[model samples]
Target chain A: MTKKLNVAVVGATGAVGSKMMEKLVERNFPIETIKFLASARSAGKTIEFNGTQYKIEEATPESFEGVDVALFSAGGSVSEVLAPEAAKRGAIVIDNTSHFRMDPEVPLVVPEVNRHVLKTIPKGIIANPNCSTIQMVAALQPIREKFGLTKIIVSTYQAVSGSGIAAIEELREQSAQWEAGKNVEANVLPVKSDVKHYPIARNVIPQIDKFTDNGFTYEEMKMINETKKIMEAPGMKVAATCVRVPVVSGHSESVYIEVEQETTVQEIFEVLKAAPGITLQDDITQQLYPMPIFAENEEATFVGRIRQDLDNKKGFHLWIVSDNLLKGAALNSIQIAEALLEDNIL
Target chain B: MTKKLNVAVVGATGAVGSKMMEKLVERNFPIETIKFLASARSAGKTIEFNGTQYKIEEATPESFEGVDVALFSAGGSVSEVLAPEAAKRGAIVIDNTSHFRMDPEVPLVVPEVNRHVLKTIPKGIIANPNCSTIQMVAALQPIREKFGLTKIIVSTYQAVSGSGIAAIEELREQSAQWEAGKNVEANVLPVKSDVKHYPIARNVIPQIDKFTDNGFTYEEMKMINETKKIMEAPGMKVAATCVRVPVVSGHSESVYIEVEQETTVQEIFEVLKAAPGITLQDDITQQLYPMPIFAENEEATFVGRIRQDLDNKKGFHLWIVSDNLLKGAALNSIQIAEALLEDNIL
Candidate 1:
């Protein structure tokens, strides 16, 4: 018999937070009690879970008092303050924000790639990798394990929903504006807090987040650094060019990787076919490949268009697509808690 | 004083063909007389050029009898038959179709990058490089010329307009479908005649053209093979992953390059600033980078987001954007004609 535990969902009204609720219910997590927490503005809202209504509560330190596990997807600042508080209250925190991901003590995890690191939760928190990083590593870990990856250069076509519900709404509105031949207004995308905003509808913006000193966006750096941390390959070379496309959900990546050993496209396909949490969709004859519209609700990391580089025998190119809200954020956070439960950690 | 030459515009009803008409008028190509030619289905339709209406003629070898310069944007099959016929009748054919691009005797030209190749036209036909390849090579040529070039890896965010005016209509219709909560119908994109069609509204399709035996689409192969040919470096290592996004006009590319010489990001910027036919829009401080929407209808190839690879000093990353119909196709074809006029070849 499985043990039931008290669960708390932070930022319950936000995009990823709501997705966490759906995944928790769909996955049939063993929960004795569940509470929805959000910012003060959304505290009075009622959310339906498991056919029962629960009033959303403002997430303070005390809100996590009786929680055994807490999933955090509230923005980085919210998690920065509340994650430590939740952890201090004896709830294992699985954060989906970028705040604690690079902390030496907080384990940045993708369960299929590096679940063993959950053994030592020094800060009592496991950081969920970035949406773009999660899908790339999930699809590549299998290939990396079989062939040994030495270098990765990834260019991302990320969905707008990765920015949150506001950006998704903006995309919807801008598309309408474009259809009407009106000016496509942008208020929430590229980065809401960034000084400049661009219409993502019918456009691709190369800058995902604010630029770092090294000329990489914070979003690009997260994919670079978190990939190294999760893959446990500090010496491996990784570079990313993250762009925000008009997509509403799934993130697509054109990834070029070089392996340490020789491998064929067929061998790589076979490895991805047998890997956990990956769906191989690479049959060129039938025109079968991954597209974001079809991958929106899927949990698996979908990979296709695998081709060996013409000039370099050791290099290969692949297209990976996964729902940014699912595997990239909410679902990954829940998987961390599930891993904890399966290992008898909670 | 410039010598005016008789010009023939083939496939004048098509997307690139209409753009060729616009470019010819805008550039004031020293024209004695101009005629519009199209397939039988489109014949007898009248098109306006320079405020004068010309009846579209069914293109045949006789259409080029007195024409000194012919620009062909008709499909490949049409070009395969008519381009040779047109060239044989003393019209120097600037073929925009892929039929003659790989022909060893035909000069595959991007006027800014390889106008020198126009000195010899053994086949009496000068081939316009693929649209995607033209923008990429136009941006990379300056860097390659200053620093010896070695390798290129490009992933494209292509516009639906590259497919044709039908794709543009499809994207517009699909956006309306998505807005109305209807199932988005796709009939024209990815490839019109290919086995599969995918929605380009809020979705990115990885396969651009028909897949070849090497698992690369013909579009990707064109970028790879044509870049080597246009750059005149037969041994240059180039790999391309072409994708179609929902943008209406401009094509955006995330390009990674390895140069034979060590170069700083500032040095590359300097080279691009001094280069012809390129506008350097890469001021990170002002949040300025080339984007598809802004690059639409522009003549210059826009380059930005220049960054040196953190792992390799010799490797660098760049974002290149250009109006696919302008610099990528029609304008480039006209530029080839202009180069011929400048060099007294026509």
Candidate 2:
């Protein structure tokens, strides 16, 4: 018989947090007792999960008293204050924020790629990779292992929902305004906290997060730094150019990779076909490939449009798509909790 | 004063041909006499150009009787027949279709990059490079002249207008349907004649044109082959992945290049600043970068978001955008006509 664990979902009312609730039920995660935690403002709210209504509680240090596993998606600030507290209370923390991802102690993980890191939870915390990073690494890991990846150059066509619910609402409202022949307004896109906002309804913005000192956005850096950490290839060369499209759910990527070992396009296809958590969608004759609308609610990371470079036999190109809310966030966090239970860590 | 010449606009009722009329007037091309030519279906219709109305004539070989310079924007079949016929009749034919782009005897031209190629038109015909290739080679020419480009990998975010006006109408209708909470239909996007059609109002399609053998789409191959021809570098290694986004006019590209000489991002900025027909909009502190919505109806190719590769010192990444209808098509054709006149080839 399987053991049922107590699970606490932090930031249960936000975009990713709400999706976490849906995924937890859909995946039939082993749960004995469930609690929804949010900021004090949303404490009195009631959320229904698995056909049962649960009253939201304000997340404080004391909320982790009886929790066996806690999933944190409440921004970085929330995780910074409460993750360690939850850990101190003997609960395993799977943080979805960027706060502890780069910390040497916290294991930045994509469960399929690096679940072994869950063996030793030094800080009693595991970090979920970024939405863009999760899908790419998950698709690339199998290829990397088979062909030996040396370099990656990726350009992302990210959906607006990766920024959260307000950005999704902005896209919907701006899309409506475009249809009405009115001037589309922008209040919350390309980072709500940034001083300048661009209308993403009929446009594509290149900046995702705020610019760092090295001329890359924070979002780009997360993909670069986290991929190296999760893949445990410190010398692997990764470059990312992240852009926000008007899509509401799935994030798509055009990835170019150069492998160390000599490989053919057929070999790459065979490896991806046998890999876990990937659906190979590359049939050019039928015009079958992954698109954001089709990938909206799917769990698998979909990849297609694989082609070899005309000049260099070692170089290959691919298009990868996945639902940013599912494989990219909430479901990934829940999977980490499952991995913990499967590994006998909790 | 420059000599005015008789000019015929073929496919004048179509998208690019209509824009050719506007661009000729906007740039004030030296015109002695102008005539509009179209298929039998559009013949006898009148189009107003520069406040003057001209009757559209059915395009036959006989239509080029006294024309001195003919601009062909019709489909490839029309160009394949009419271009050589017009050229044989002593009219300089500048063809916009893909019929003659890769013809060894026909010079593929982007005026800013390779105006010298106009000196000798062996077939008495000049081919306008593909829309996506025109803007990229124009921006890269000066950089290549200074630093010597060795390799290029590009992924494009193209607009619906590149597929002609019907695809544009479909996107608008789909936007309205999305706003009404109705099932959005797809009829003319990705490729109108292809077996599958996908929604583009809030989606991005990775395939443009049809797929060729070796798995690269014809659009991708055009970008690869045309760049080598226009830049006159047969050995330049290039790969492209073209995708269609929701925008209606401008085409944007995320381009990565490796140069033989060492260069800094600041030096590349300086080269772009001094280059012709390019606007450098890459100030990170000001949150300024080129976007398709802002680049619509603009004449200059906008380049920004320049960054050096974190690992390879010689590799650099850039974002390039331009109005596909203008610089990528009509304006470039008009510029080629002007170059021919200036070089005494017409």
Candidate 3:
């Protein structure tokens, strides 16, 4: 017989939170009881799962009393206050925010890349990687093992959904106004509340989050720091430029990597094809490559457009795509829980 | 007084050809007489230029008899057939097709980068660089001269208009279909005649042209070869991955380059600020940067997001944007003609 544990979902009404609810049901997780928790503003809301309606309650320290696993898709502030409380109550917390990701005591986990680290989470918190970082590391982990990665330079074409529900609504409204030849306003994209905003309808924005001291955006820094930490390679040279495109769902990355060992393009393709959570779609003759539109609801990280660099024999380029909400945020948090259960850690 | 010359615009009814007509009128080119020529299908059509309606006639060998300048924006096959004939006459042909760009006797020119090479056109055929290549090199030339470039890696976010009129129309129709919850069909994007077609309404297509044997698309190879030829650096390491976005007019590039000499980001900014035909828009505090929605119909190439690489002290990153029609094609061809007149090469 399988084990059925109690699960709690924080921020149940938001974008990533709702996705977590759907994914848990879709994956048929063994749940004896599930509790939906959110902010006071959304406390009275009702969400249906597995033919039963669950009423959302305001998440407090007391809410984690009987929970065995808590999936957190709330913002960093919520995670900062509630994640530790939930973990203290004997519930393993899978945090999908950046607050505890770099915490030394917390284990940042991507099941495909570094699930073994979940065996001993000193802080009782497993950090879900960033949406952009999750897809990239999932595709790169196989190559890193086979060829030994030394450097990575990635340029991302991320969708608007990664921002939040408000940004997605803003894009839809602005695009309609643009098509109708009316004036459009932007207040949510390229970092909402940043005091300045740019229109994203039929345009691409180079900024994703607040700029850091090093001139890299917070989102770009997250990719760089997360890759090194997850790969356990402090010496890896990783640089990123994250841009918000007009896409609504999937995130696409044009990644260039230089490995320490020499390898052929065929060998790289073979490695990716056999990867755990990757799907290789690189057939030039058939015009086959990954597109974000086709990757909207997929769990697999799609890899394509694999080619050798012109000057460096050990360098190669790849196009990687995946649903940011699935593999990037919600599904990743659930997978960390699955990993914990599979390894009998919980 | 400026010397007036007879000019003929071949393929006068196409997309780039129409933009050429608009730019000619906008820039007030010195023309004693301007003739419009097209294929027999568009012979009787009338196009208005500067309050004058001109009749389009079939272009034959005799059309260049009295023409001192012929701007060819037709397909490569058309240029292959009629360019030599026009050059055989006294007309200095500024061919905008890929047909003659690689010809050793022909000079591939971007006026801002290599106008000095226009001093002697031994073959009477000066080729205009590819639209994507023209904007990139125009922005990179100043840095190369000031810092001494050794390597370039570029990923392009090109607009649909770069494909032609049919692509623009397809984007519009597909966008409408997508919004209405209908099935979208693509007929002319990422390469018109390819068996597999993907919609570009809210998606990014990685393949810009037919794939080459070496895994790089023809469009990618164009950027590689054209950048080397126009910069007169045959041994420079150049790699490109061209993608088509849902944009309408402007082309944007995320470029990474390694220079031979040491320099600061501020020094590179000062160099580009004073460079001809380039505009620097790197004000992060004001959230000012080059965006395609704002770059439409602009005559200058805009550069922004300047930063030094984290690991490589000599490597830098840049975001370049320009109107694919204005600076990329029409304005570039007209500038080449003006260069010829200024240097008395014609």
Give DockQ for candidates 1 onward, in order: 0.93, 0.83, 0.79
Worst 10 residues of 3 chain A by lDDT: A11-20
Scored on chain A only, each candidate's TM-score is 0.99, 0.99, 0.99
Off by over 4 Å in 3: none
Model 1: residues >4 Å from true position, as ranges? none
lDDT of 2 by residue, A87-150 (tens): 9999999999999999999999888999998888899989999999999999999999988999
Candidate 3 residue-wise lDDT, A206-299, digit = tens: 9999888777889989999999999999899998988999999999999999998999999999999899989999999999999999999889
Residue A140 accuracy (lDDT) in model 2: 96
Model 2: colliding residue pairs:
none
Report the lDDT of model 2 for residue A213. 84
lDDT of 1 by residue, B95-203 (tens): 9999999999999998888889999999899999899999999999999899988999999999998999999999999998888899989899888998778899989
- Candidate 1, overall lDDT? 0.93
What order do you get sorting by lDDT, best first? 1, 2, 3
CAPRI-style docking class of model 1 based on DockQ: high
lDDT of 2 at A24: 84
Candidate 1 lDDT, tens digit per residue, A1-346? Answer: 1899999998888899889989998999999999999899999999998789999999899999999999988888999999999999999999988999999999998999999999999989999999999999999999999999999999999999999999999999998888888998889888898899999989999989899998999999999999999999999999999999999999999999999999999999899989999999998998899999899989999999999999999999999999999999999988889899888888
Chain B TM-score (model 1 vs. true structure): 0.99
Clashes of each: 0, 0, 0
lDDT of 3 by residue, B1-346 (tens): 1999999999877779989999888888998999998888888899897799999989898989999999999889888988889889889999999999998889999988988888778888999999999999999999999899999999989999999999988988887898889999988988887888899987999999899999999999999999999999999999998889888889999999999999999999999999999999998887888999999988999999898999999989899999998889989999999888888776
